[model samples]
Target chain A: MYQALFFLFAASAVGFAINLLIQRHPIHSALSLIGVMGSLASLYLMLGAEFLAVVQVIVYAGAVMVLFVFVIMLLNADKEEPSDRSKMAKYLGLPLLFLLLAMITVVIYRQFPEDAMVQFGDFPGQTAAIGRLLFRDFLLPFEVISILILIAIIGAIVLAKKEP
Target chain B: MPPAVILFTLVKILLLLVVLLTAVAYAVLFERKVVARMQSRWGPTRVGPHGLLQPLADAVKLLTKEDITPSSAFRFIYTMAPLLSLVFALLAFAVIPFGPPLTLGGVDAFQVADPDIGLLFLFAVSSMGVYGITLAGWSSNSKYSLLGSLRSTAQMISYELAVGLSVIGVLLMTGSLSLRTIVDAQAGTYWGFLPRWHVFPQIVGFFCFYVGAIAETNRLPFDMPEAETELVAGYHTEYSSMKFAMFFMAEYANMVAVSCVATVLFFGGWHGPLFGPPSLQVVLPLFWFALKVFCFLFVYVWLRGTLPRFRYDQLMAFGWKFLMPVALGNVILTSFVIVAWPALSRFWS
Candidate 1:
């Protein structure tokens, strides 16, 4: 059952990612990206990281993708016609993308062996455990990241403040 | 995984769907009746006794109406949007605990599914629920649709933060995100007098949560997206017939979902007085839950009739500046109280 669910979501994730690239309308692409995020969230659930799965959907698919779709809608963006400026991305970017994918696959394979299986409820990366980890084990990194987010918020406020 | 578990889940899902659809239908009737009374007029008295059969009539009318597609509209997304909205709206209920856990033939059978992150799952689904309105507007290829969607996207995004943050106070007190655990935590009474509901201690959080929920659901005082005078029915301006009915149902369903969440989070969910035989005890929780939910639906309609629509700027300012800060402060206060709780008790003793 686990493997079946894993294969289903993983295939959908890849399919949606490809569709995101191929779709002409920006809104279609944005929706495809959301699809990818949702499928990836399911894969995260299969990994026993329930907290991560919900956060992935809530933060990325729910909030960020809404903004993406919102922008596409607000601008009334039309289908993309490739401009002369995108030559490098169309052809040259393929090899780089493949290399990145390969690198990630290699890292994952090395980290997880066949015996390192994903039995759904075996590992507990639940909210409380994750909380303890962030507040106790990785407190400095967490605080630093929060401070960075605070700085970003301040910067955004400054940028949004209209100049007289 | 097992066949029994799967069967029970399927049964639960079917039952919840029926209950949810019925709730949505009656909520509409309830709103119309109450709003009419507030305006010193009769509402839907012609259909059945006290408008009991009104929802049935509405369903028949909507289902039989012509589903017109605008000439220039984006057909696929336009058609898909309302279903998306409705599916996500109903999906949130799968995780919500309707009553205490009940087992039938050795299978846990009350909730559809109880993941460790059930509460967060609700948030995730609701956040995604914005897409229905957004896409419907964008796909309609109409200016009104675009404009209405623009407001909804902005409003939902802005209020989503406040809503999520407000609930953190409840999470802190309960120390868990599962709706079942949250309900369990609120069971019994404080000092044998006051109900041990989060509402008593986290009143500020409840305030922010309820207000944000109203905004998120686009109810009165925050329903800028659908202001008839300005936007001409907002995102659903181009929708007609069953398509329009879907959006309408989605709106009422979303309202029910939020109200259920409010009841579970703040009020003691199904924690009222219990008595009588075992069978009655089993069902009284459901009764209390339905009663509380009815009260919430009444309040929602009451506000709709009583309060005027907010100016768009006022809505944004209220959500971002006032509600967000207050919710953040409530979270801080809750965490502080929880952390210093032991010391405070020691001091008292």
Candidate 2:
């Protein structure tokens, strides 16, 4: 069951990523990105990272992608206008990307044998464990990231504000 | 898990779906009737007795109506939007325990799925509902739909912060993310009379939560996205027939989900007086849970009838400038009180 679920989610994630690249409209691409994020979230759940799965959906798919869609709509973005002289780049890019991905897959496959299997119930991702790690072990980085987010918010407001 | 357990869960899921669909259909009727009475007029009396079968009639009408798609619209996203909305709206209920666990054939059964991160799961699904409205509007290829959908997306995201912060108070008091644990924390009463509900102590949080919920559901006073007078049905301007009904059902479903969450978080969910035989004891808690949910739904309709919609700027200002700060303050105060509760209770005792 675990293996089947993992393969299904992984395949969907890759399909969505490819769809994101091929889609002509920005909104379609954005939608595909959301699909990729969702399938990845399912894969995370299969790996028993339940907290991370929820956070992945809540932050990336829910918040960031909503912002992306909002901007696309607000700006009234239309279907992509095909660029000129892209055949050489396209052909070269695909093969290079495929080779790189295959190399990475082979290296990881060799490093981690088939015995390193993911059993869903073996590692329950309880919130307490995540909380302990976040607050105690990574306290400084957590605080610093929060401060950085605050700075970003302030900067956005300033940038968007109209001159008096 | 055994086959019996699996079958039991399937049965439970079917039952919950039917119950929720029935509730959503009736909620529409309830809103129309209450809002009509508030305006000193009759509503839906032409259907069944006092509009008892109005939802059914409305369903048939919507199903029979032509499903029109605009020529200029993006076909795929427009088609998928309502389904996305309805699915996420209903998915939140999986974690909401309607009543205590029932022992049937030596197996525990109640909620569909009670994960450890139930509260976060609810939040995550609810937040993802933004896509439905936004995509529907954008794909309609209409300016009004675009404006309405954008407003809704912005409104939902802005209020979500307050919603999350307001719930922090309850989470702090309970120190757990599970809805079941939160409900159980408020099990007993105080002074032998008052229920030990979180509302007494977290009154400010409750206010913020309800207000945020109202905004989140895009109801009156915060429903700028679909303000009929201004946006002409908002993001769903181009949707028709069954497609339109999907959006309608999604709205009511979200209302019910938020009401259930409020009941679970503040008013002890299925934790009321339990007495009588074992069968009665099991069912009584469900009654209490339903009563609380009914009150929240009624309040939602009452607010719609009584209040006028807010201006777009006023709504944004309220959510950010006012509600967020207040919710943050409520969280801080709640944390302090929770830390000092023992000492304060000793003095009072």
Candidate 1 is scored at a TM of 0.96
Give the alpha carbon lDDT tens digit for every residue of B122-233 in model 1. Answer: 9999999999999999999999888998999999999999999999999988888889999999999999999999999999999999999999999998999999999999
Among residues 3 or more apart in sequence or in different chains, the pairs in candidate 2 whose N, CA or C atoms overlap within 3 Å are: none
* Local error of candidate 2 at residue B277 (angstroms): 3.2
TM values, all candidates = 0.96, 0.95
lDDT for each residue of candidate 2 in B1-349, tens digit (9 for 90 to 100): 6888888878888889999999999999999999999999998898878879999999999999999999999898889999999999999899999888777755456788778789999999989999999999999999999999999999999999999999999999899998989999998998999999998889999999999999999998789999999999999999999999999999999999999999999999988888899989878999999999999999999999888899999999999999999999999888887889899999999
Residue B314, model 2: Cα distance from true site in angstroms: 0.4
| Model 2 lDDT, residue B21, Cα | 96
lDDT of 2 at A2: 78
Per-residue CA lDDT of model 1 for A1-164, tens digit only, reads: 78788899999999999999899889899999999999999988888889989999999999888888887776778999966767788888989989999999999999999587667765677788999999999999999999999999999999999999
